[model samples]
Target: MLAPTVGAEAAEAVAGEEAWSVHMQNTNVLQGHTKIRSPYYGTNSLSQAPQMRQTVSLDLLLGLRLWSGAEAHLDGMMWEGFGMSNALGMAGFPNGEAFRKGTASPNENISRAFIRQSIGFGSEMEDSPSSSLFLKGRQHVSRLTFTLGRFGAKDIFDSNAYANDARTQFMNWSLMANGAWDYPADSLGFTTGGAAELYLHDWVLRYGFFQVPTVSNGISLDPHIWKAWAQVVELERKHKIGSHPGAVRFLVYANRANMGSFQQTLNNPLRPADITDSRNYRIKYGICLNADQEIATGVGIFTRLGWSDGRSEPWSFTDVDSSASFGISAKGTAWDRPNDTLAIACIVNSISKVHAAFLRQGGTGILVGDGRLSYGAEKIIETYYDFAVRGWLHVAFDYQFAVNPAYNRDRGPVHIFGARLHWEF
Candidate 1:
């Protein structure tokens, strides 16, 4: 949905110009779940349960044009809130110290203040805050976009694409693309910190500088904290096969950092890894294909494939290893009733080791896994319906099922039923 824009409040070099945008969504959900201790410790049993959740968000932006080919912006999230476990999946311990410290809350306060410029002859200046500079020339395409300060690492294809709603809490699992989900405990894998994006033709590359993971520091010396792990850098490419109905995207990415290495340099101030030795690096490569064809009246199909390796050789950790997951997604409007849309999707996740070493008792992140090696992988299936009530409002119903022997031990599956209402303009 596009937010409406109005004329500037002042004409002085476009200064003092401001605009506001808001997004609100709410959802009610019911869920059933069960969990077993471990494969060798429990019998196959299922427990019945139900749950509820709510979410709200708001964004405000202000822009000012400094000179030709240059502009500045202040965009911030004014109101961000989430309640309950509407089945977004846990990114971290939902009730951990981070939450108690207010560092991690259902309600988030995030913003970015940045500027942009175009430096070249024949360059066209566009009012874009996200892209530092974008240039298009005959037979050539290049964009140098850098986002400093703070901003979201979200994209259309993978980042919270399906599960972000004001009425429903953002499903954390939906935030990850193929490579980001390989190891859940690796905090340096993907971060929403200062990052840059460079695009050339069908390819887009990105990298970020963020905080180190798995460290505890005293409050007085918190600002002295330094990063222990390597910064994250990734590359993505999307290309059209031909005029035919097909397109493909490939990704190659790597990041190195010390996960648990932290020490106090002075006065109990936390200092990240200063190791002269080689830092542990985890890398991934993935390819996905998207195709579409109208077989009949308002009917279509979609599919995707993904795989990744979670292990980094020459490292201190030996638990998480290779993992492969794939899914097929299809959505088509009913033949007779073109106004009604039906969508279905299923994704399966597999880990190389039986139990995930990353989420063990001694490990970090969300501990949904059993202490024993997972004898098998986990699976999730989701189906949803989207019906357009108007141009700006939509009503949707969704159902999801997640099954993992390691996390739920003997618990068979967790099922969630949800209802959503969305209004974006």
Candidate 2:
């Protein structure tokens, strides 16, 4: 009778532990900025002179363990405010937190809702702690993960530890993501997708398919997944240098949609030829290489190189045909403040010869076009320092300088300054 009672108590404890697997997270970010010393005003330039703009966003992330090796997650978000010139004028825009469409009033949207299942194939086990969208538990090191539902392709592809998150890291669009990959997304940067990942001891492979927006950079996504879709694959390898850790990833993506051809637009003799008039089932593809390495106790380095076929209009992401960026980040442990961080990076963005001619002929892209073109590579340098106020709160100061804004040499050497406040729990 005593042995049976002890067994029953152990079973009850295990059940209670399983029931506590549900978790919730909340994050809020407030960012404000002003661009100073603007360049010559072109018809399509971002607003000249010093103008102040601000944006605020809040996210509620929730996760629940549904069954063995399965979990469900959801995110509710509220966003408001505007970027400089309503997020226009620059290909490598300065504020990553600001949406392209800014509203005077706050708006709510469902950013992510998804289900994930993991299947183990080997006996190796690992402890996975609760972080971001994942729930806390023990997981198999060699396993297969399947995810389905609405999310950003960037959530699973082109990931970099030092340069991924905009709220806490770099503020430029090109620095946050590979500018030339052109991964599919709506105006708000979310889409319905499904992904599968295979994890092994030293490497992982991931593949994803996602829906594209109905129109070019439109807010509404196309429901016809078969007609308009994007696919991506990534291979990642983890290694150690001495006693430090590092990772490298190679990603390639292809997008098929009703997009216009740049050369076709230029050939049309119609007065003020438009790229949109030639829309058809066209394809765009790109590749990216990303790496991150921990050099010292709290110092790390990251870099990315990307390229895309420049014939098609940029369906999503930015307007660059080629890009390269590298940066270094270090924690404040040297000063006995372990939570603080400082980082600096530089990105050079360029377009193809045909792409340059399109802009020179008064054609506009999704993010760029200055009516006329004095073409030069868009070069940008950005840096930021983040100071942690508490375990969940951080304040950061950021700065960026861009030459040849929007690939137009006649336009700008713009200077931007910003501040960000972020809280997560």
Candidate 3:
């Protein structure tokens, strides 16, 4: 993606831009984990058996200017393959590109189809660069933007410079996002919704409402819009510290749906300790704090803190109650490879007492679950080095170590090695 250009809007810059833009990207990730010391296993546990797994994704972005300040975009996407243990076993799953809905063959979908209208308020402006998400041209700094249709909530909120993209940055589930936010989405992480963004010179406020799954982590969304939906609000502040730039975002979200109760599951444990046996229409809310700062030229740091009420099951995202992570990203400019990147991050994930107790009673979640439990906070250490092979093509190597896998201390201290290849134009 092109960097944000904040400056005067030039006539030529606007004239040089096309009325429509098309972009294409593809990513392939292969990962393998070492044999783990496991005495037992569950259906949803990260397989202790050592094996290699892979996932591939392709995206095509099309954007067309509808009017002076209106644009429409359609994203065609295809995905194939699976994640380790099918993206199960841990709250901080190690493969961001891997979706739980794996396919033996390529599956296609309209990942994003949205319309955006931006109303500029001030005379000051900057020439924006072309990217897959939005159009490139001159735009005012202080503006009100409205977006509607199908898209991923993560696309609008929790923006981070150092640890956001899975194809190019960190590959862990928690590292790429505020794991505990549980933003509205379907199995493939897309949802039908609308978002409004108010952008001021130094501050940004955004609100979004979207449909959630009818059942926990289901593919189909409930049609009872009022009864099953999600609403989120985020406040962002961009600042400069001693010539360095940084941004902090505070977010809060509430979800309403027919979700299961952890306490209810434990109180009346089923044959398999199924939480869904106690489903009810309830609300789950949470908050998140995210920050990213450019500490020095070519070096940046990022961190995220998130928590969600553990009363209900995770309706959309991973199985996590609380999460915290921080890391550093430094470009290889020091070694003359400006396009290269090196980064490392750590994560801590935990569940509420009731949530953990449910698992101890042989309950299962969207991800983390074992037949029995010896609970502990899940800890992860991940590092990667991306090499710019040439032009838009790049290759990267990644490594991750997990302790107390799936919040079970009785399990691992597993080591995972990975490789990724990505290209875009």
Best by lDDT: 3
Q: Model 2, range 1-425, lDDT digits (tens) per residue?
A: 00000001111114233322322333233433345344444444677666678877776666777888998877777788887777777888888877866789998888888999999988988876555576667889999999999877888888787888787788788988898889888888888999999999889999999999888888788888888999999999999999889999999999998888989988987635578988998789989999999999789999999999999888877789999999999999999989999999999999999999888888877778767788999999999999999866788988888898899877767778888887666
The parts of candidate 1 lying over 4 Å away from their true place are 1-48, 61-75, 78-108, 111-141, 155-176, 179-194, 212-226, 229-234, 241-247, 256-258, 261-341, 354-364, 370-374, 405-409
Q: Where does model 2 exceed 4 Å of error? A: 1-44, 271-273
CA error at residue 102 for candidate 3, angstroms: 0.4
Clashes counted in candidate 2 amount to 0
Using TM-score as the measure, the top candidate is: 3
lDDT for position 179 in model 3: 88
Candidate rank order under lDDT: 3, 2, 1
Give model 3 RMSD, 1 decimal.
3.1
Tell me the tens digit of each residue's lDDT in model 1 across 1-425: 01111111212222322222222222222223334222332111122334444333344455555554455555444322232332123221111111111212444333445554434332433332221111111211466655544333332232222222222222214212332322212211212335566666556666655433342211111122242332445555544333323334333333333322211111122222122122232233233333333334444343334443443321211122332333332334335545555655454444433124433322222223333233445566666676678645667676666665334334445655556565443
The per-prediction tally of clashing pairs is 13, 0, 0
Off by more than 4 A, model 3? 1-14
Which residue window of length 10 is worst by lDDT in model 2?
Answer: 1-10
